[model samples]
Target chain A: MVKVVFTDHAGSEQSVEVATGVSIMEAAVSNGISGIDADCGGSCSCATCHVYVDKAWLGKLDAMNPDEDAMLGLSTDRQDNSRLSCQIRLRDELDGIAVTTPEFQF
Target chain B: MSDSIVNEEIDRRPESKWSMVGKDPYSMPLEKIDLAHPGIWQENEFLPFLKRLREEAPVHYCAESATGPYWSVTKYKDIMEVDTSPHIYSSEPTIGIVDAYEQFTIPSFISMDPPKHDEQRRVVQGVVAPTNLKALEGLIRQRAQTILDGLPIGEEFDWVERVSIELTTQMLATLFDFPFEDRHKLTYWSDVATAIPGGGIIDNNEQRWAAMEDCLATFTRLWNERINAEPGNDLISMLAHGEATKNMPPMEYLGNILLLIVGGNDTTRNSITGGVLALNQFPEEYDKLRSDHSLIPNMVSEIIRWQTPLAYMRRTAKVDTVLNGQQIKKGEKVIMWYASGNQDDEVIENPERMIVDRPNARQHLSFGFGLHRCMGNRLAEMQLRIVWEEIMQRFERIEVVGEPERIYSSFVKGYAKMNVVLHPKKAA
Candidate 1:
């Protein structure tokens, strides 16, 4: 199992043990973590699952794909560390990855 | 009579030749196929046509049809491109392919661009907020239990009328605080609101107006009553007292009312019916459900994706836009076929079959996306989740006994009649 921490807009953090190969967005949803609507079901569309990866762990995952990047660019709150959680698969190397969800996903 | 008028309109229109291709969809080139014709949907021949469009021509154009020329975005990625970029692809004027009759188009927030759309949407958004949804859960579960418990076992009955329509209409009545005895009128108005002339629900435009006038009159009375009362939680009261919506014009008020009614009624209702049909179609999935009830919520999303209650939403090009290398001219109708998008193999693996536990189930475009996404989506999902939970505890199977009589229109992809019989589990 890989552990990923999600800090919601309210500053509450939830660390969930997700099975390897599951996307972080799926982890947040199946764990019932709030603030990740994941409305488009983690497709590279619908930026509802946008999250800011912790600076230290950002380079651990593969580079963001163009589709995910375009969707993130649509968000007014995007940051350098911004990533769509749906695009990041949970792996053994990314056990301690952390990301913060934006206040609004619309 | 309505058929003759359609024939007359077709004969008079100089553009009718292009539309003739739609008459024989099977022989027409895949790229030229028009799924907008109500006949294609009514005859239940739309599935293969849509499949072909998704494969051969992801962004095909139909230059002629009952609703005129429009672009069909069939692939998941292409549909998302149009749906997300509201600025280029405007929902203004209307969302359906058919133009609203002259001086009759209602301007609801769903059809408005930002500033106005955001402001008006904020007014009633509270009705489906998380806090409100939490409060409504108990009531929805209780209602679902009552509705399910009332169904007769071992007897074929129309599930569309008894289960799907009844539960959704009940929810709508509570939302508006509408008269319970007259709650069926909500369903009636919803059907009439989206009905196509000679499409089996209404005969002509005149009858359509007559039905809508009845809807307007009925809701106007409720509006008047609620406008003066203390602010309440019901949808009518929300609009009546909302700062942005308190003084809407007659047509705008009617438009918003129809938006809420149809938005609330159809999606969830069809999913309820579709869920049973899908389970029956794939019994292993039903076995999966029976073995693990925890999959209910995910399965709910899967059902909505599989059914895609609303097939397509039309948007007009505010500016010329090139989507998937296809030039969409300004003012051209660009339709995002959610039904096709939901089945796009590129996005969803093995897109053909129902897998209740599909991991990315909620990724489907059934509730739409961006600012105009279905406002009552959470409410819709909550209702479905509760009903199915109650169903799992009660019955071994809700067998689909006969063919589902589908609705006539291409817009609302749903059932008109679905005969079902409940197979009750013997009391432990």
Candidate 2:
């Protein structure tokens, strides 16, 4: 299992032990964590799963694919650390990685 | 499967494609792809043809079709591009490839562009808002339990009518605060609103028009009643009191009514039926589900993804645009095949199989995207979750006794009749 923390826009934090191979979005949804609607599932389509990875662990994740990059580009609150949670699969090295969800995901 | 609800004669025309069912769809040239014909879907043979289009020509154009020429956006990324880019690919003119029966075009916000669309949609958005959804959850679960408990055990019955349509129509009735006793009328009006002329319940344009008129008259009566009543939580009351919706013209009112009914009905209804059929088809998956009931919510998303209830949503090109290297001219109809996109191998790990616990199961394009994304989406998901939860508690297995009778229209990928025999779980 991979341990991950999700911080919603309201600043509430949820730490979940997600099964390995599951994306961070899956962990949030299974735990019923709010702030990430992930409307399009994890197809890297709907940016509802947008999240800002904690700067400390940003370098550990894979580079954003063009599709995820383009979708995040459409987000109004996108930041340099912005990454769609659906695109971020949980891994051992990222055991304590934290990500913050935007206030609203259109 | 028995004969479809729609008459077979309607598909016997010389130009109809029903006769080509046995032919290998993959062998056909990409240019020959026409996803509009309902016959192909009624026969349950649309998958391979769409797969071919999605693989060989993701943005292929069909110059000749029952609904006239249009572009098919088959891949997941391209579909996202078109569905999200509402300005470049207009939803106006109509979301269905074929224009609304020329004589009966009621303009709804789903087919309108922004500003106007956003203003009108806000009126009823509260009905499915998070707070409203929280309040509705208990009511939905109770109704689901009642509906599931009432079904006969070990008897073959049409799941579509008995379970799917019944629950959704009941939800629609609750949303509208419509008369409980007259809830069946909601189903009838919704069917008539979507059925093609000379197909199924509607046999002619006159019959279709009369049904619309009746729908208008009935809703107008409700509108007048709510217009004077104290503000309530129902959709009618919301519209009656909303600044942007209060003075909508007769046709626009009818348009919004159809939008809510079809939106609230088909997606959940079909997913309910499809989930059962899918579980039966992949028995191992059924075992996986039976072994772990915790997967119910995830299974609901998987079911919606697999069903892709509304096969496609048509958009008109607002201006010349280059899509996936294909040139699209202004005023051209572009069909975004959500069903095809959901199964695109490039995105979905195993696009063909049914896996209840797919990690990113919610990533399907079934509800569409952009400003016109389904407003009742969360509500739809909640209802499915409740129904399946209630089903699992009562029955060990829902045995498919006969082939399912699919809805005749390619537009609404659903079943009209699905025979199932319930096997209740023995008490411990």
Candidate 3:
């Protein structure tokens, strides 16, 4: 299992563990984390699953695909480290990854 | 195009002779069912026909209709597949059931494919983005209060006119930085843009074209005024200075403007009216709401699902594709029935009931899915949320005193007239 920490807009953090193969979006959703809406059910279509990767762990995650980049562009809250959690799969190398959810999902 | 040319084109087009009105769903043959007809929709008799289609033929085809042959995708999952795979199911030329005539068609991002679609959508989407809505919330609440406070208690009034139309029109005007006094023209043009010819809003295509010309002229003046000014937060200013849109031709500019105006206007207006009607129909749910005001946010989503305003969006098949075991050929029209999918019992439990606190209400198909999903979704939600919050504070109940009249078009599902009486809260 890989560990993931989700920090909400209010600075509240919730930690959860899930199998390594599942996406970070699934881990957050299955663990009942408050911030991630994942409205498109992890298709990377809706930008609702957006999260800002912690700067320390940003390089550890896989690169953003064209679809993810396009979807994130529509968001007014997009930032330098912004990523759609659905596009990131949990892996042992990224076991202690931390990300923060935006206040609102566009 | 000149008025004489427009008249000639209108005269050449044939009128729709087929209608599904007064037809019994159970008695009709399976292949004979056509959901495109505005007859059953305006009468509020579309549910059974939609149910029949979802059960028997999830991806059914209609060979002969006013809009020509098209496939009806009623299941939620099937609709999702079609929506997400834009490469297979393209949104081009037009998204309406009826094919666009060369002279009448106005090119907009909604009907364009990717690269171009992405570029154009990115330019104006920020206007209604969540961050922008935060700024708009205060203004929206103040307007809602003014409109609601003006209502007469214990007296019958047309809620559709006084509240729904007025509130949404004001909101639209604010978005465009339009003159508040002439805001009613936005509502009229929106109605005209989506109006089905011979559907009471307009007698024929000529009238529809004439109204559109007037809309174009008005918006053109707004564009010219804003183009050289300092960049502002309003939508018109955004488009006037937008890199991808600034150099667009006159027809394209008018098309995009009409798209935003109609997109912002009718959908929410009907949902506003629909919420009152839905709560009246489901008094127990209304009781649930009165007891816990926290349910207001969730209730807003349920109301959107129940209304399913702007019932279906049309996509043309780009290639020979098989969806849900049904074959859709190249260049054929595929209509995703959001109204039916929202009520698909397989996905939503007790699909017909208006539960105030229904879980996963935001997952409904009302705003659609994939690339062309409604850009103004958050704005619409905020407007509904604020309206409900202010409403609970002031009125005990918004009672629907009479039968609500529905709109004529199958595309824009909403109320045309609804008599309502406000009941103020008894002092605690």
lDDT of 1: 0.82
* Chain A TM-score of prediction number 2: 0.96
Relative to the unseen true structure, what is the C-alpha lDDT of residue A34 in candidate 3, on a scale of 0 to 100? 79
All candidates: TM-score: 0.83, 0.84, 0.96
Q: Give the fraction of reference interface contacts each candidate recovers.
A: 0.21, 0.15, 0.59
Q: What digit string (tens of lDDT, one per residue) describes model 2 on residues B1-428? A: 11232233334232466334566887777687677777778889888988888878999899976667889999998998898787798878788866645322478888888768878887887787555777989999999888898999988888999999999999999999998899998898888777767557676556766777888899999999999999899999999999999999988999998889888988789999999999999999999999999999899989999999999998999999999999999999999999899999899988888899987787788988766777787788889888988888889999998789887777889998999999999898
| Top-lDDT structure, candidate number | 3
- Report the lDDT tens digits of candidate 1 across residue range A1-106: 9999989878988899988999998998999888887877766666778888999997788998766765665454678998888899988999989899887664
Candidate 3 C-alpha error for residue B273, in Å: 0.7
Return whichever of 2 and 3 wins on lDDT. 3
| Superposition error at B147 for model 1 (Å) | 1.1
Clashing residue pairs, candidate 1? A40-B363, A41-B363
DockQ winner, 2 or 3: 3
Pairs of colliding residues, candidate 2: A40-B362, A40-B363, A41-B362, A41-B363, A42-B363
- Give per-residue lDDT, candidate 2, residue B102: 34
Q: How well is candidate 3 docked (DockQ)?
A: 0.70
TM-score of chain B of 1: 0.94
